[model samples]
Target: MTSSVPVLMYHYISRWKNPIAVSPELFEEHCAAMARNGWRGIGLDDAENFFIQGKPLPDKSILITFDDGFLDNYVYAYPILEKYGHKGTIFAVTGKIEPAAAPRNTLKQVWNNECSADALPRVDQPYVKHELGFDERQDPFLNWEEARLMEKSGVMRVSCHSAWHKSVFISPEYDGFYQPEKRTRTFDRIDSDIIWGLPRFKALPRLANRAFIPSQRLLAAIRELVPQETDAAYAFFAEEANLERLKTLVQGFSKDELGSYEDSMSLQGALRQELSQAKTTIEEELGRPERSLCWPWGAFSPDALSIGKDLGFRCFFTTEMGPNPAGCASRIHRFKAKDKPASWMMMRLQIYSRPWLAKLYSSIRL
Candidate 1:
């Protein structure tokens, strides 16, 4: 009889400001633990046989997947897996994979014939926040050279994440979100954008000038509501109670001025484009078909699933914290393998290995 095994999901492999990030040390420990134990890594073919053809898996089978295609995946995660004799699948953001970037650090210094797994983290740069003044719409990702090495070695399977992870994070209506110069986001630069935004809006390019900066009155309201330091203003914005208020304030702008920034963010078209590009590019680059897809932020609608099926992606992985139900592997769920220690993950694997326990927990949670 077939049993449901755990599929682990991961994001950035770094020590950064992100809550989703997992440190390299901790990650290595987790992989080592899996290797020390009897856990075996499975490929897309193994998964397809079990899920699509209803074939049972080998003993103690597990699936490791990484999202976003961060360069750190190669720097940190890949070598560890290779050393431990484990395997993984990196669902890469295709469009972000190729940029003429040097190694971030000096370990081995090889993007050419000298390419070894020793010195990487290529491109000496910090993990710049995308929302900041940096044009990080497609950076901090693996170059084709690194990707090809990983894929050819059979240690990691390079699959598809999507074309651009941007449309998923940035609000479609917030034109100012993209324009770092317009960002008075820092505490020291608390100068209200409302004073100069309107004139600048008229002067800038149509697509470039899309953010709806706060009006003078709205700025005053935010100030009055928080009335202290910049931190208080930020706290107010951070609070859930301020969402409706923020919406009301944002609506004060003229529709013509705000443009589609105020429009309901429908990413169906964007998702289609991304999925198509990711599949095509990954296949072209890696010489393998992309059969699985992990959604950005684990947010996907029914329409997205439908579109994915049409695009030939059979497996859809989500952020939902639970085990994949037996015979229902088309839409699988995974828990974040970051933040927690290896021991915690060990316990999670234990629970998942026993279907009855997982079923009981799910039933209670549901």
Candidate 2:
């Protein structure tokens, strides 16, 4: 039988109790199960050769990936992977990862008796806490020092998840007002300046949408018109009567006062710039060529794929679910690692390792 690898995608190995997060205890259990079952974790390069070049990986080989470069991956996930002798890849937003003088304390330090487990930093801090402020909002992401330590340990590889990992307004159509609560949630996914503007506009992931450059004059006018108080603003937009008022206000603006959308050329150029900058930053900081990219929010277009290929990205991870068989390099499919028991994860791994079974299961599930 031809060899196929199942790619498992994870976001935060934290106790934050979110859909995108798996608790540290469950993550360790998953890793331990894989290790005990004699499953080998493969990196992007190995997966590329197997899928694109028709090279065979060993039986029970899997590709493990973590998105967004959460610090928990370094603190909690890294130690467990090292203990299990499994390798993994982290697709990090290069723009968010700052340089630190030294790596932070991890569970590894606790295990080695260098520090007590209580000394480790907490990963459960929720990002939605507006009181934490913008600077403190960066606490969740991995710094370059931590990334380097993981890469050097031969247990983790850091790659690009795009430079900004943000979304852009795709149209001038106002979807809903960006309330204070919503603003805090978008800090990591949008420009700080734009977030402050509280852009009351519809948007799609940056790579997926052409940039809609809104008129600053109109934005400023809208800012002046809206209530300044957080509760008042939230309530103002929430009332059914105020919806038409907001729409009329936006309609009052002239075409020049509204916004302009990027043409095909401009959109392509933007994608190139974003992807290039990410690749350059990751290579320069990590001291190695970055050959893999996982699209932010799994949002990518044909243009994005072409640009990525031009930029020398060999593997492009997507949220598409299936087994990665031979000749499936451009859109490598991955299964989201759920916050479930080890038995559930092992069962998924077993099913996804076979192309035929994976296809059947996906079709039926869909």
Candidate 3:
């Protein structure tokens, strides 16, 4: 039996000049390194058994995972994995897939809102930019054909990552009921973090502006509702009771920004249905149900987790980085690789192999 192995998670593997993008050349080199080292790339099930059943994988086994179904994984990572006869798992964001080639603007324009410097409290901008976005329909983020082709290749295994990558807090008004402070603070924290955390903070005024500008209409609604309460206390109470139903929503989004509480829940339900349909399709192709899943952006809450579990998935992946010791949960830890060309992976792999360093990193980060 082989010992536990490192499960590597990736998002985009491309030749972009952005620091976040892992160049094709470097990606190939990393795979080549793994091959030379006699690493046997395994699937999620292999790790599950090793950790849960006390089964050992062949020595040098590694599990490779790609998150969000980026097109770069297909355009860039797929050929390399095939070249090395390596196997990997792709956590598909099912909502991103389209029947035909989607317009380039849809991909890029959706994620394009540069976050505000003083980030506002609203749903994290649901957009992706094309020069900045990976075309899910056209390129690497696999369309139906590419996904089926990859699944048939024997080296690639596909799984789910929710329909829209909705965060754990995505549903209406749930956060205020449980984590109001954390939820409220997200508006400011996201603003400051994105601006200050990035290399060029000053150039990102759009991020601040994008967030702080509240819709003028919601303010008016709030004002009108408050005044009429005294004049028609009974009628106001009736309306206020209905409005209270939107407290969580109002905390998250203005009534004008979002039509009503029911609308929000409807969108969330639609997303869950999309995920269920994608999982069913992927399973049909595999001739077996996909019992595992990965959260998009590693964003999930009890509601999201329940949805995944109810959908019949056995395990889900996360971004908590480190070696998952035997007996560790399947909702495992994975680190982000920023510094690389192999040095970054190698260092972290070494750290994960060392209990002390793993403990140190967790403690410091926590």
* Leading candidate by lDDT: 2
- lDDT to native, each model: 0.62, 0.81, 0.55
**Tens digits of per-residue lDDT for model 2, 1-366:** 346789999998988877888998999999999989988787767777886777888889999999988888998989989888899999898888867667888988998999997887767775444552322343467889888888888899989999988888767676555554533352345432352225556777888878788877776876776776766665676676775666677778875568887788888888999999999999989888877889998889899999999999988889878778977889888999999999999999999999999988878876
Q: Residue-wise lDDT of candidate 3 within 1-366, one digit each (tens)?
A: 444456687766764444445766787778887787677677667776766666767766777888777665665567678788688888886766644343222111222454432332111122333342222123334666666666777777778765555322111122221111112111122221221001111211111121222234544544444333322432333454644643533555543463222244654574457558768866764567787777655655565567666878767678776666666655666766552877667666666655467768867886
Candidate RMSDs in Å, in order, are 9.4, 3.6, 13.5
Candidate 2 lDDT score at position 17: 77
Winning model by TM-score: 2
What global local distance difference test value does model 3 have? Answer: 0.55
Positional deviation of 210 in candidate 3, in angstroms? 22
Q: How should the candidates be ordered by TM-score, best one leading?
A: 2, 1, 3
- Candidate 2: which pairs clash? none
Question: Model 2 residue 65 lDDT?
Answer: 96
Would you estimate the TM-scores of all the predictions? 0.68, 0.88, 0.61
